[model samples]
Target: MKVGLGLPISDPPSLLTWARRADAGPFTTMGLLDRIVYDNPEPLITLAAIAAATTRIRVQTEVLLAPLREPVLLAKQCATLDRISGGRLTLGIGVGARPEDYLAVGADYATRGRRVDEMMPVLRRIWSGQPHDDQVGPIGPAPTRVNGPELLFGGFVPAALKRVARWGDGYLSAVPVERTDPLFRMVEKEWGAAGRAGRARLVGQVNVALGPDSVVEDAKQTIGSYYASLAGTYDVHMVTTADQIRTTITGFADLGADEVMLYCWAHDPDQVDRLADLLA
Candidate 1:
């Protein structure tokens, strides 16, 4: 399976440095996460910068909160970014988990799932150069690819999984194999039921913090604080050792993952070479 490196969004100033290092490393793609309520930079804008800075690796949103943005404008931004990146963009989307993020944007948190379902088609329509109803012109600056960028659907709900067959190009799982195995199977089953040819591309995620004890401890605390306010107990698997990383990647490959992103939580750029040497 291919391996991607997820850059840390906590430190915005060092992002390009990390991107530059990752671009020269043994990584296929670079990923970023989204959160409006958090201190992290916006995924799309940051990814645009990363795409411009790097020539080899792809830039992706690990999971952009789709229901929070305006569909037509988002379509335009995505199309522009896709072209700017020379078609090296993958838009992973989901109806987010944090109610605070929705509330901050004045989006109806209760209706997010429905909003995302409605938004997907509108995004495609805009990307196809179709004029909005009663408007004289269509959205300008077409995408690099025929129908905009590749879309990977994220989230653990049944409706979320169904979206893979309905509109997405694949599934993005943020959990480990023990939890993600059945979900991937369900997505494949839905793909077949929906008469989609071939199989759904399955991408997996693993949170990591590979470095000295101080860095690993800081990452654990940061992760805990960031996720402390959620409804239930938030338990994320953060593989710290090189052995753990190897074993985790192997496990995902066994589960038939197309690509597995190492979602590095440590803000240190040195972590890039650390992982590169291990993967090499």
Candidate 2:
């Protein structure tokens, strides 16, 4: 199983530092969380910077809110980033959970899932160097990969699983394997049913922060605040010690995860090295 590190987007300035550290470490990918209304940096743009700074680590949006932006524009941005990253971009997308994120963009919250269904094919079409609108020319800067960046879909719903089989290269899970294992099986069933050759990739994400007392406490506070709105509805999944991190990775690997992204909630760049040392 491969291990990946999630960027601390809460501290924008630390992104490049962390990315470079991850690149120099055993980490295979550097992931980012996405949101429109939050104080965090935009995933794609921040990832572009991270790509420029790091050579080996793949840059990914652990899950970008796909319905918030125009599909054509999103395709262009992702294609451009894929080129900038030397084909090391994984486009993880989903219909986001927060209504405020959609409301801020004037997007319809209720129709997001349906919109995502409609948009996936269009994104593929654009990436195929096909003109999104026949009236306009084909989008330029074609993706490094034949079909665009490897797409990973997120969400626990049946519709989300269907999207993985229909349009994505994999499934990205934020939930634990107890919940995700069944979903992965369903994805495989759907993938085979769809006649997609081979199996869909299974990616997992866990929030982690390892450092001094202050750093761990800070991570707890930051994460708590981020999920404040969802309070009772959301459960914060964070591990603050090296033992927990190792255990989490082993558990996911045993569960058949292709890659596990360790989401760093604290904004300390040195946390990258700390994680690397622990992993080493």
Tell me how far candidate 2 lies from the true structure as C-alpha RMSD in angstroms.
Answer: 1.1
Task: Give the per-residue lDDT digits (tens) of candidate 1, residues 1-280.
Answer: 7999988766899999999999998899999988999888999999999999999899999899999999988999999999999999999998877899999989999999999999988888878888766855788678887677999999888999999999989999997767889999999999999999888999999999999998798788877777878727555778999999999999999989999999987789999999999998
**What would the per-residue lDDT of candidate 2 be over residues 1-280, giving only the tens digit for each residue?**
7989988767798788888888999899998888988889999999999999988789998889999999888999999999988999999998878999998989999999999999988888889988778588889689998789999999988999999999999999898655667887888899999999988999988999999998998889889888998888766889988999999888888878899999888898888888889888
For candidate 1, the lDDT comes to 0.89
Residue 128 lDDT (model 1): 82
Please give the distance, in angstroms, between residue 9's alpha carbon in candidate 2 and its true position after superposition: 2.2
**Which ranges in model 2 have alpha carbons more than 4 Å from their true place?**
none
> If candidate 1 were superposed on the true structure by all CA atoms, what would the RMSD be?
1.1
On the 0 to 100 scale, the lDDT of residue 113 in model 2 is 96
Report lDDT (CA) for all predictions. 0.89, 0.89
Cα miss at 250, model 2 (Å)?
Answer: 1.1
Shift of residue 18 alpha carbon in model 2, Å:
0.6
